[model samples]
Target chain A: MDEMDNQFVTSLKENYQIVFQEIGLLEQAFTHSSYVNEHRNMALSDNERLEFLGDAVLELLVSQYLYRKFPEIPEGKLTKLRASMVREDSLAEFARECGFDQYIRLGKGEENSGGRQRNSLLCDLFESFLGALYLDQELEAVNQFLKKVVFPKVDAGAFSHEMDHKTKLQEVLQRAGDVFIDYRLTNEEGPAHERVFWTEVYCDGQLIGRGQGKSKKAAEQDAAANALRQLNE
Target chain B: MDEMDNQFVTSLKENYQIVFQEIGLLEQAFTHSSYVNEHRNMALSDNERLEFLGDAVLELLVSQYLYRKFPEIPEGKLTKLRASMVREDSLAEFARECGFDQYIRLGKGEENSGGRQRNSLLCDLFESFLGALYLDQELEAVNQFLKKVVFPKVDAGAFSHEMDHKTKLQEVLQRAGDVFIDYRLTNEEGPAHERVFWTEVYCDGQLIGRGQGKSKKAAEQDAAANALRQLNE
Candidate 1:
């Protein structure tokens, strides 16, 4: 390795204590598909494989943590909380805090197009990093690493990040072709200026969630949020 | 604890080495929701919470193992293989092998209705056991336990259990929401007694898979199977 590469490895080790016995694994974690596609002689693979493995590892660790943390919470609630915790945006935040964007190797086009700061890229980069760490350090080490990085955020409630539930719900239901989602205004009451509307969301004629607000749009959003909560997707 | 309960706990400790500091936790692992529902005076919760935790633990451990064992396998193949390994039927088989059916505490109605041997119940039971084990002993011990139970199955090729492609594909896509799956007969040619039929499967108008067989039904099944393999779901 050159002096600059040695410094990069040493810095990561000194800062995050992320030691990779096989340095190639670390390189692979940051290598984007665009980079691999651009370089014919590149000895490294893209981060997708590592991201896949890391995705499972990340999920398992978080789920285990939540299960132990909230002893009384039921499965449905735990699922919802877990979904919120591991969503792409939340993971991208973790990546940004960890400086993963600085390490990503993007092709000229992707770099020019601002791929380094992309949410999906950062999220996948974070997972790939975890995958590399897991291979070199194994589960206990990964657990300890997550305890240091993620657990504090979880404890301080930093990971209770905002989620666009209306869009999220729509995206999920849209992927399944035959299912229909309908938000109906079930009731409207109160004065004109102080009007209240109750909305109920249904999936294939089955009522999934209900919410009330001053406007139909607000009521629909609330209803969509409730549907997401109840469905636990 | 009663005499039967004492014997049960002691036997598990002696045979399986599952020593619980809080015996209530162990008891809670085997407690079914039906049992808690029936016994109003019982001061115990169901296994659902533990199952949820255990499910995460199980996925992480399995993912780590696969990543290490198959260094060259891509993410798509690894995901499909992992899904097969951790599906409900596979977990239920593991539970049966562990003899958890005898220890499950079902309500009189459920017990009489044969809930003890049900695949869903056994799968949840297995996860609950792992959850209780994790809480009592932590990750390393739980890892060792799975290493004994699940790893052997993976090695012996016992875990490549039967999976119906059409059903599994539909279930996954349905969960996603907007994709429609359709099987089309593309070609049929041969003698009357020995004829071959070709089929293609589409997902939302995009051709995803194609296959050939002796009969139309068989060809459609082959097409669906191909779709599952090609889509990696």
Candidate 2:
């Protein structure tokens, strides 16, 4: 490796505490599909594969951290918390914070279009980075890296950053002394084993929003979520 | 504790190496919602709360374990695998295997209906079990228990299974020397940032199944899943 490349590797190690046995894994994590399409036969794969693996690992680590930190919260609350934390926007923010944009190799057109700063791209790269970390070092190393970096945010309630619409709506209704908010199942279909239900949420006899899910309970939750969104709007 | 209860606790500790610090926690884990409903003034909480916490803990633990074990698999694949391993069916099976069915306190009606063997009920109880463990000991202890018991089936590749209908349809068509398989994007809606897609999958020029999802990719997967089901039928 040249002096500049050596500095890049050293800097990454210093920042992430990850030593890339196959630097190609790291490179692959940063190489977007646009970059690969532009350079046909360049003998480099896109980061999609790595991103796919990293997404799971990141989710697992984050979920585990939350469960350990909060013993009092229920599953529904935990699911919502985890969803907020691992959502695309949060992943993108983490990617930008890690300074992955500069290292990401994108096609000229994508670069021109500011693809490096795109939330979707950043999220993909973040996942790809996890994939690379898992392959290059192993689970322990990946766990260590996440614990040092990601776990702190989870501990500080970084994932539950926003008050969900449902909670907000409930507060609004309760404060108004209205308890007429009801969610009713409108329709259902599919086999008994995997039925899907459509639900509509109403407040004070006024319809607000509709939602669908694999179960009546899930559909009701979705309806509540939609109502929350409408209230926010 | 009564003689039967003491014996049950003793047997659990002797056989499973699990010593519950708060016996009430373990008792609560086995207390079904039916029981709570029937005996409204029992001053005992239902297992729903525990199930919720346990679900998160299980997912996190499974994700971490899988990441360490199969460092090569991508996140999407790993997520699917983890989902399969930790789904209601698997957890219910684990509950039954652990003799949880015998101890679960159910209502008379539920007991008559053989709720002990019901996957949904079993799964909920299993989550409660995890919740009890988490509250009684710690996250590490719960992880250790899971690793020794439930996680092994997954690790042993007992439930490592896959089926792709899109691929199957394509294969059947190719083998039959026909080009009758088609997938069409029927509708797209929602915000541009979080657009959802609807798709229809056809085989031999016949509309076989339909699906909807958050993205074209997910819609395609749903379509494929539906198509596979139709083929199986």
Candidate 3:
């Protein structure tokens, strides 16, 4: 039997409660580029391809879940919710919770470099695993896995901060209706290449907050952020 | 009987060969917000919810097809490929080919504004229809529908240009092996708020192309475009 026919399949079954009919897919999902590079004689592809597929699946599931859960929310707000849920940091946290890091098969160099502890590595691995799972058993099995692991965090308000401050501020203001909120450039300095910009955000005619940044867009974002903070207080 | 149960369902069955068991889903897919707003007493919802669902379904289907078809392409390239395929323009073209615009239920105001002819509206309609199809009939039917309508265009070389020029140029250079590509900021001008930046793209220590744009990133993209055009020539 191949490497995948043994401990790999058993461990997936035992730990994750995942049973793979196409065990090779499960194995490939755990196999990193580093591992494949180190093991040239063995025929094994890396998880990057699977990671690609998994990322889409994960996004769709999260998006669907959010859409159903937040019936009253608009598309833009729903987008932010999805983004926060699927962002690198949250996916990495999900990976850590699932112990997906421990299962990652890396080259000796990457393994020695503490690849397992790295959030990026773990996040990619989680995505890769999900991709493989989707292929092996399709969406039903994948949904079960996510329901057991990921969705509960939504109820705990863990993702509340993940929403963009500017968007949140706008949503709050827009719901109140017909309020003119404007961001104006107040100051500009430094060289053209490394320019600094200061912006003031006004609610009606009163300056609510001021902020500075390296670009006009950045400055506006900072100003909005400041306004959000002040308004919240 | 509802509007969908009458000629709408008959036409879908006749034209698209799509016999939706849950015909209500197919109806809602084409039902615009304007229709729901105009007919407030009618227990009809707009297609936005299905549009959201369909967008994800379309993405997943496209991703799966690409993954299986192109075994040699890297994930990044696959992502670019997917982006090109699902982009509003391409999807709008797909909608036009499918004649989705003809069946869309729009508000009278929107309809008078030539909404059906609008690419964005048609594209959303196509996605909403697909979303509704997935809900009613599932993946097999969706796959069959796409095979008959979508995948043929892919083979006719319709999708070849959707991938970014920079990545294409890089891929070409990389295929030749051990080549260095560098994008340099050649010049910066105009005001900080409306900056015009020039960039030069270098391949293997030689400048291949130069371009200017409003932002550094845009300038680099222009430079990359120039390089690709030069390389093609």
Candidate 4:
């Protein structure tokens, strides 16, 4: 390994107690596509594939964790909680906490444009790193790694603010003697990859608030949040 | 166990070579929420939570399978392949083949409404069953069960028809010369849960085809498919 690669490996060992049996996979995880494009002769693979696998890995682990931790939380709430935990900002925060910003390799243009500090890049780096860890050491080791870097934040209730807004709206409305509440999807628009969904919340069949988001559940939550805001005002 | 429950357990063992150490979980897996609502005095839990867990479990397993099976396939193609494998229609078909339809219990209203043969209910039943198996025997057992009931269909290439239409269309368009092909999201509409997306495919800045679907990827695929059809004619 080169001096930088050696330093990267040593840093992981010294800082996080992580050792990769397949050091190449570890290196590949940090190698962004832009970097590979700049060095085509080196024939380096990018982290996109690893990011894909890691996304699924993170999802399953987070789902299992939430399922066990909050047995009383229904599926809808669990879904929301899990989303809050793994959203781009949260994953980027986790990546920053691990000091991944120092190790992620980028192309000259990306480096000049401040790609390392970007949340999307940092989130992808964290996932790709986990994907490499899973490939190198399998699921249990990745689980152990997450226990150190990811789960503690969840345990500390860092994401509790993202609790079920729909349930909260229902509770707020029901304070007036079992008031009927409903949420309906009003419309959806945009391209296939970036679809926007609009939803409206109603009290006793009267529309109280309308909001929009990328998914149905998110739209419902947005509508509920708007309803809550209106009531508070 | 009641007589019907015993018969259900026996059928599972005899037909699928499966056994559950925790019979209550097995029973709960087959119990619909409607049935639980009707049997409120019994305090029996429904399968919603199990279905949630199972959905994640299925996603991971299918993702892992696809990742390994198609190491050369890009992440986007793998994602499309995984979607095809675990989609509602596919899951429902797997449930029917496994004879899960005979075991699922519903409330009188649902039973009268033909819930026993519903694609959605059957899909949820399959997921809940997998969830119960994962909880009872853990991931390996669920993997083994899918090997028998689900993975074989994938191995047989039953879902290859849902292959990347965008890629196929690109190949077709590229045959004449270096042609610029573009896909744009034209519009989106419908409710949040069932949001519809519309996409237009163009060649050399001229609109060739337009199509719609519930997801961005699906819409793009629909557009590509439509474009391909137009080219063929």
Candidate 5:
């Protein structure tokens, strides 16, 4: 291994205590598509495919974790909980916490454009890293890696605040009495590929808040969150 | 075990040549929500939670399979192939082939309503069964089970026709000479939860076919499929 590769391996060992059977896979995971596009002679593959595989790995592991942790929680709640944990921002936060941002290789253009700090790129990097780990050591090693990095945040209830905005809004509204709560779809816009939904939440026939999202349920939750903020203010 | 439970276990062994470590989980896998509601005194849990976990398990396994099988294919195409394989209709077909439809428990009302042969219910049952298998024996056992039941169909190219309609259409259109193909979003309707998108595919600015779907890409694909069908006719 070159000095750079040796440093990378040593850093992983020092930080997470992870040893890779195939260090190439680990290097590929840190490789961005833009970097590969620029360096054609190196024959290096980007992290997109690894990101795809790692996304599924992360989904299954997170699902398994939530499945065991909340034995009595219904499937819908569990789904929401899993979503909160694995969303782009959360994953990006985890990647930054692990200092993965320092290792990603981006094209000069992307680097100049501040791609290193982008949430989507960081999230993809984290997932691709997990994918490489799974390919190198299988699910158990990936699970152990997550037990060190991701699960503690979940255990500390860091994501709990993002889970149920609608429920929280309802609780706040119902503090007065048994009031009628309704969410109505007001408008939808954008192209078929990126449709936006707008929703308004009403408390006893009074329009409390309006918000928008990519889906109706998300829009409703957004409206509820808005209403909660307004009510608190 | 009761006679019915014993018979269920025996049928699993005879049909799939498999045995579960925790037979109760297998039983739970087959229990529908309606059945639990009807058999309130039995304290039987429904398959919904298992279905959630199984859905994730199925995604990872299918993803892993596709990732290995087509190393040359891009992540986008692999994702589409995975979706085609694990869709509700496809899963229902698999469940029916495995005789899982006959084993799913339904309330008398649901039975009267013809829920036994419903695709959604059958699909849920199949996923729940896989979930149960995973819980009882872990991913490798579930992988073995899919190798027997699901992977063969994939190996046979049973689902290839459902993939890449747009690409197929493009091949046909480009056969004559250089041609410009365009997909235009015509309209969208329905509530936020069930929004429908309509798209028209045009050849050199001439409208060829129109179709609608849940998303823009799906609508575009549907339009392409319709164009292909019209051309074939």
Candidate 6:
């Protein structure tokens, strides 16, 4: 590794408080799958697995912090808050703030296509970074990283009761008319263990929107969310 | 108020070590919107707020616990495990086991319709219960409740890598000899803040599924997930 790479590794250890025996894992965490596929001989590992791990750690830490901070919010609202906090856009923004774009390894094609700047990819790298941190330093270190990085970014204003989508949707739709929202099951397929549903939203008689999910209800909610956004816009 | 109620309350405090002051919050946690709407006179306090609080608390505790217990597992696997463990179904099951159903204050209509037995409602109540626990007791108390009621049910065997439909669909389609899954955008309308998109999945020149979401990408993913499920079936 070059001096800059060594310096970067040292800085990460100082920030996350864990020294990695295999800086390879750190490299892997920052490596996009695009990079791995491009260089077949390098035996490069992708960050997808690490990102997945980091996502959980980040969620837990954020969830706990929010719970402690706001004792009055409900589960639905909390879920939304967590969702908002950890969404791809937010995570990507965090990655950018942390200078993740500089460290991530990308294939020439990906680099040409601006893959390093993509929110989805950046978000994945952030998760991978967390995963790498957890792997090297342990959970406590990951927790510390989350506390320092992700928690502060969670908007306090957005999480309050008034800002909740379901609530907002309910209030806005109720004021419009006696319109009842129904989620009709348009289609269903797959095994009994893991079924998926396609649902459409009907507002009065108009077919407003459609959504799909692992279950009928999840699809319906997604449809409702879509409809709500449409109506608001 | 009655003998059964008094005994239940007493047992709750005795067994759980959560004081009655906190139990009051727990009782409130089981109150759903259905119950609140039914009893207009009471202007009832619902479990939504508590559920929100509890959700955050639950995530943190589970994350911390999983982090401590599984050292060898990478972050991605740990995240999936934690998500699987703390999802709605698990929370609802835990609520039922904690005797949360018996304490719920449902409207006569909801009660007659068997609201207490509903898993969805139970999940909310359980979240609210956690919220109340956080407020009435302490973080330690809430952690204790989670350890006793929620942790055991999360068998690692049930945890699947392909839990998310979007990821599953992507993998499935990629393996099915299709490089580009065509998403036909039917419509997109709304403001910058809340935009909705309607899209259809086209594979081999056939529209397989339709979906809608706040963003085009989400809608496309939904369609892809639906298409994947249908293919599997």
Clash pairs, model 4 backbone: A192-B216
- What C-alpha lDDT, on a 0 to 100 scale, does residue B14 get in candidate 5? 88
DockQ-derived CAPRI band for the predicted complex in model 2: incorrect
Encode model 5's per-residue lDDT on B1-233: one tens digit a residue. Answer: 66767787887788777899888999899999999999899999999999999999999999999887666567788888899999999999999998888788899999999999999999999999999999999999999889989988876657767558886676567657678889999999999989999999999999999999999999999999999999989
**TM-score to native of every candidate shown:** 0.65, 0.54, 0.66, 0.70, 0.71, 0.53
- TM-score of the second chain, cand. 5: 0.69
Give stretches of model 6 more than 4 Å off: A10-28, A34-46, A61-82, A107-109, A131-233, B1-21, B34-44, B56-90, B133-151, B154-233
lDDT of 4 by residue, A1-233 (tens): 77877887887898778999988998889999999999999999988888888988898888888787666578888888889988999999999998888888899999999999999999999998988898888888888888888888866547757667776666556545667778888899999899999999889999999989999888988888888889889
Query: Against the hidden true structure, what lDDT does model 2 obtain?
Result: 0.76
> Where is model 5 more than 4 Å wrong at Cα?
A1-4, A162-233, B1-4, B162-233
> Model 3, stretches more than 4 Å misplaced?
A1-11, A70-73, A112-114, A160-233, B1-5, B41-43, B162-233
Candidate 2 Cα errors over 4 Å, as ranges: A1-57, A64-73, A105-114, A128-233, B1-16, B19-25, B33-46, B60-79, B107-114, B131-233
lDDT for model 3: 0.80
lDDT of 1 by residue, A83-107 (tens): 8878889889988887778778889
- What are the per-residue Cα lDDT tens digits for candidate 6 across B132-225? 7777766678777766666544432244352455545544555435455578999999998998999998766778888899988889878877
Compared with the true structure, what per-residue lDDT tens digits does model 1 show for residues B186-228? 8899899999999998888889889889998888878887887
Name the docking class for model 6: incorrect
User: Which candidate, 3 or 5, has the higher lDDT?
Assistant: 5
Best by TM-score: 5
Sequence-dependent TM-score of model 3: 0.66
- Which docking band does candidate 1 fall into? medium
Candidate 3 per-residue lDDT, tens place, A155-223, comes to 555775755655555555654565677889999999999999999988788898898999988898898
Q: List candidate 1 segments past 4 Å from native.
A: A1-21, A112-114, A159-233, B2-17, B159-233
Chain B: TM-scores of all predictions: 0.66, 0.68, 0.67, 0.69, 0.69, 0.62
lDDT of 4 by residue, B1-233 (tens): 87878887888788778899999999989999999899999999899889988998898888888777656567788888889999999999999998889888899999999999999999999999998998898888888888888887866548757667786676566646678888899899989999999999999999988989999889989999898888889
Q: Over all chains combined, what TM-score does candidate 1 have?
A: 0.65
* Model 1: DockQ score: 0.51
